[model samples]
Target: MTGWLDRAAENAHKFAQRNPRAVAAGVMFSLAGFAATAFGVASPSAPGTEIAQQIISEDVQPLPVHEQLEALAAHQLELNRSTAGRANDTADRLLSRLGVNDASAASFLRRERGVRDLLDGRVPRLFTARADESGRLKELVVRMPAERRDQITTHFTRVTLHPAGHGGWKVRREQAQLESQVRLGSGTVRNSLFTATDEAGLPDTIATQLSEMFSEEVDFHREIKKGDTFSVAYETLTADGEPITWNEGAGHLLAAEYINRGRVYQGMWVRDAMGRGAYVGMDGQPKQRSFLASPMEFSRVTSGFAMRMHPILQTMRAHQGVDYGAPVGTPVRTVGSGVVDFAGWRNGFGNVVEIQHDGDRSTLYAHLSRIDVRKGEHVEQGTRIGAVGATGWATGPHLHFEFRIRGVHQDPLQVAKATQTPMASVSRAELQQLATSARTQIAAARSMGAVRAE
Candidate 1:
């Protein structure tokens, strides 16, 4: 019997070697069955057996009143305030308004020449101050326009005052570079362009650019009806992330869209290889015409080129030119690039300046307080040749602008519209990309304006 058992074991070992995978599967099946049987036979608890639970409660006590008061006293807060310097602002008054009662800071501000200069300008300067809980000034900063005329747009002046190592004070005055920030704005014309821009918080410079951008399509002076809308994306110069006041932080107008009388106009700024940039339509055509509709940057048309009662003559006569009502000394520019044909006092037109352009076209600017150009001088479009004045046979300050074709009087607005805007050869792909970006920005600005209105 022992020999027969040994022979059977030998046979089983040989079979396992021949079929290893089958042997492994059988072993796993047997283990699973064993586990199922063990679980099935597990003993059950006694009938009606139950667990127990108990509730616990206690009151938490805070620290003593004196300890709490000490903790509160250890944590002191600092306050910051900012305001613009007023014309009548004294050191003490300014400090008081900023919630600082420190006499030393006020004394320093008055005693330091640099600090006093920061507050001397008629235009307000931005002032920022920091103080402790006891109203003691810890730091003061003043920001204003750069003193250099060439750097006003590119730089800003910063004056700082703080406590030194000791109880004394340290002052610093420096010029910092201005940073350009891209901004978007949109508005609707309810009354006038200025009023709409004021409501929209847009800079006056940008508002003027918008008018110039679509001068050929619409007459901003007379044809701007109610319900007209516009959107703009522009660059604003900032000093340390704060918008500067001088020049209203004026920069470049990047892109603009205007809707007037159910007509839509859009333009995007495109630069050439020479680094010169201009506003162009989505089709890669320039928008700036050779002539501008208005001689001045922005003004109202007091009289049109038609029959009107002469203020001085007191007789109905044909008004050969358009009269623009503006304040005295308002800058008057040449409508188109040309040479000064005449620059002097005339019979009815005082301080007159006539510019002769190509194609037998000439423009006239009269009633000037001062003449900045001379006869035979070459002047470009938008060049300030003189200023608005009442020197001519006029009752008030205004600009008399006229456009002549072959010695014949023509409407200035009409002439501007008829003049063709020269288109420059540009890369179609580049212009299309720029126009696409401008469209996105303009849409965002419009949506933002709608949200604000809501």
Candidate 2:
């Protein structure tokens, strides 16, 4: 008998090796029969088991890949039902621990219904529950929806639990703290202040602030010259030893200084009386002048004050002033503090304004389209007196700027020279000390390659 059983076992093993699929089917059928028999259900051979046999028998067909995927998906859905219910229960428990009542908890769950949409698609789903060292549920994360990554990330709102001493959790919005630093360098310009500031790594917002600071002295669009240069000290946003710049919105104007030509133009960021940001001079005065030095930012001098034949009139005219060829309505300014002595139309000089200064000095602006200041009105240095226009015996819109000494007309361009205010004797010592410190700082910055000369 033992020998016969061994031969049967060998034949079965060989059959399995030859037809693995049929063997697997037979094993499945045997498992089904055993399960029925073990459960004490009626067997196929037992009397009065016809009803059970009919119930168990069915016509089965092989399913395609798509159908098989659908079946697996349905089974996964059944499993996820329990998971989803558990998640909802967990969310409820979390909310309850956070002091939310039943009504509020329901509303909160409704608000988070979007989390359910994650399971409806054919994508893979992963659920992870995080716990503290004490095995308390600290967090639950359900990663899904590649497109909603950012949105889901934002939903990771934190709920702080009261110290373990307390019985429940206290929920609150989470916030992150940020800190930054900046180091601004300086540069010079041979053209416009706007262009130069851009080249110096300063943003438009900072450059605009700098322009506003010196608007009274420098006409950004008109008065800048080729030999004019500037120096600035400022700061930039930094993090982890790297500088940062924003493409939109004003970043920051830490601090800045500018020196145009030989004039020391300085400005620092400050809060105004109304608590608004602004740039003001070191002396707390506005850096702006009333008017600009020239009608054009950079233009060549075509005519000077001398005897010359009038181009259109065909007569030798004693040209008492210099001609600045600029566009129409180019502004004319008083070179120094003075009072308007005359502002009206003249026979040879079009619409003109004459400003009488101290020390028997005066200035005349002729061939103007409009006069801004009235006679007897006090005008400061660089104050706009009129607009350039061909209102008199002139050929084009150009400012006829004249300088006079005791009523004798002289060349305006040559008479005016760059002058520095004399420092008081007491202030001179302080200035020298400041200059020494500045030199040292500037030298160090240069050695470290923090500054570049023009």
Candidate 3:
């Protein structure tokens, strides 16, 4: 113990022996003061009046206020911007909108191999161009807003077009100088899919995309029940240079998920190790199936494949095809890539278009009023082969669709569901890596109302 503390303790011992209660109280108070001092607390040793009498006070004057001179800011120059019209699918129209009067430049842009997609109908855009007084475009900037997760441009990428030497034009790509924002949307399925998505303030296009994404796992047409919920995480585009962007609608839907009757399905756009993108599942499986959805865009199934009493024949027989009732001359589409096997008449089947697809599978479309494809000609999926009609086997106007595996008939509904192919291994792994972001997006989508990204 310190010498001062020891002396104090000795004095306290003496006080304790004389009056223990007074000593105990004084010890507690002393300990409290000691503790306060230890904690850097200012313990006043003298009374307020004594301290005030011994202290002096003084005040300093404030610094003099001064006016500072500053230079005026310059105004930003606005780019001359114009929109490509609906009929602007051609290079002439595109150059015209950009105020380019040069005919050779227009022809160059039209015939250039690399610029076809920029000039296509799918990505029609407004142009920000620098033109001369004579109406010759010195430079052109076209904004390509990201539309899909696997797309080339992530944010707002620009395609800058300019004149090259030798009276020719060249194109250069500009990185995304624009900002991208994330947003959320959520809703539970109630009466209909559109109603539920609309209630969540989601775009109809996004809802449709979500349905197509999850079609392999959930049947949106019949399996969707009440209380099933869906959520989406998407992006919006903006720019510092242009306050008003030509981009419309929500951009790429980065991630989406669904909880249908206690089962969960998620889809996230993931870029593989090779930098290729695909929508994948949590288990690293490629989930999207590219197939012709339905032969008839809109129709009612008047007759299905089953054994029934034939309308023309008296005896009950096996009905080998599904009949879709439509108008007299509705366009029928080929469901898959194949060669036309027989685009001619049969005994019971009228004008038929039989397609020989891979894996010994063939699709037959019968009762067509007219045929557009010739036998032995290759026809891609979604090709207009013929029009639906009642040409043979006495009946009303209906499309007789049949799916055959090695000549054995299979149900059309089952065929459609079995056609989905898993993506490659690289894409699957790439998609799995995006699980973390995808899950976070789903959470955001579930928690918030529709929020646009800035």
Candidate 4:
């Protein structure tokens, strides 16, 4: 029997040498068949039977680990692409539903072009897939980066009807709870606020809110200067303590704190003394100043307040007020609280609004595209009275703002000052304690690497 086995092995080697490729294939097939049989093919009665029969049996075909992982990644990428496109579409629909005009939506989407860069990698993106009981995709979230999450939340800014004490439902503004942040390093300008805030981990909407907060004083397109720094703190909405993302529900802005060029500015969402919803300073005052430091945020004063030849008129004029060479409809605001004594078209002044304030103070706004406040109506400091226009004796769209004391014209730039709100005696004492606690809390938060939502 030993001699016969040796002879069979020698014959097999000779056959393999004659047909090397065929032998190798046959051996591989036999090994595979043996494995299938060992793992329990459909029919244990046949060990090395037909490959098709073995496959049809209970033998499971196991994929390699690496191939399985590759397949999973591909599947996830496909899902991400599909979800992202759907999210974009959903955003457009939501914007339309919220009454955002097509032009505005286009502009907004244009500004959000950075989203493409953010979705570069096959990163796992989480989005709230809102659906009915049927499990359909009702909404898809274009997940915002951690830095911009606060500003990109899915919140609605709506005007609702409130029950008036006398009769009909009066239109009132209401919003969902939302949070935003803005961070501007030193030596930055106002125009770049959005970009800077985005880097510092704020959302675009929050940056817009920040700009609006200081619109009366800072012109994003003009007024910001190098060496100017800013930071913001604000609130965002959450569910069960988890901040909601854009794919979730909406939120409201609870409060905000801003600091610019060493000056601290703050705002709180509150019901005013008249029960109207508004944002006010820490002292319950509006977040505004009498006048902006410069009409142009970054432009040098080409001309000062003095007697000079008018550029277009080419005649020597007193130039009573400062000329802010801004675009048409640039808002012109009141420097202080007052009543509009005059809002009409005047010779050499075009559309004008003359305000008379307490202490014999008065102000005049001329060359306006339109007047907002009516005559005899009271207005607060920084209230928008008109929009800049090139009317009457002007060469371009610019605000011709003037300040007066007892009817005597004064330099608007030098005359306007910020009125400070004095703390009450009791409140002052409480403030000291509050400040102490605040300092401690701030330190703790900093140590823990946590940012505050002011």
Highest lDDT scorer = 1
Best by TM-score: 1
Instruction: Give candidate 2's error at residue 297 in angstroms.
Output: 4.9
Residue-wise C-alpha lDDT for candidate 3, range 308-410, written one tens digit per residue: 7899887898788788999978999999887899998987789899998754568999989999999999988889999998888847888999988658786
Q: Show model 3 residue runs off by greater than 4 Å.
A: 1-77, 80-82, 86-123, 131-138, 142-185, 188-190, 195-206, 225-227, 234-254, 261-264, 269-280, 285-432, 450-454
lDDT, candidates in the order shown: 0.68, 0.47, 0.60, 0.45
The residue-by-residue lDDT of candidate 2 on 1-454, one tens digit each, is: 1232233345455535754554444421111000010001112122333332232222111123224446756865422211211333455554344333344323433454544343333433233333433334443334332233222211222222222223333333342211122223344575666566666555565565556556556666566676555443333322111222222122334334445556665554432222223344455443333233454455556687666898888999888778888777776767778799999999879899988765456778888999899989998776777777898888877878887654766555534321111122213333333334333323322222222331
| Runs in model 4 lying further than 4 Å from the true structure | 1-302, 417-454
Q: Which candidate would rank higher by TM-score, 1 or 3?
A: 1
Q: What would the TM-scores of all predictions be?
A: 0.55, 0.29, 0.38, 0.29
- Sort every candidate by lDDT, greatest first: 1, 3, 2, 4
Clashes of each: 0, 11, 0, 13
Residues 352-424, model 4: lDDT tens digits: 8998865446778778888899999999767888787888877777777777654656665544322222222
Give a tens-digit lDDT track for model 1, residues 1-454.
Answer: 1232233345445435754543443421111000010000001132211110000000001123224334644653247777788888889888888889887888877887767776675865888888988998888888888866446666888888897745578988899977654566777788987678666667766776666567667777688779888877776776765667777675656678888887998886654433244557767778756677688888999988776799899999989988999999999999888899999999889789999975456899988999999999999888999899999798999999998865878777645543434235445555665677677657656655554444
| lDDT value, residue 20 of candidate 2 | 56
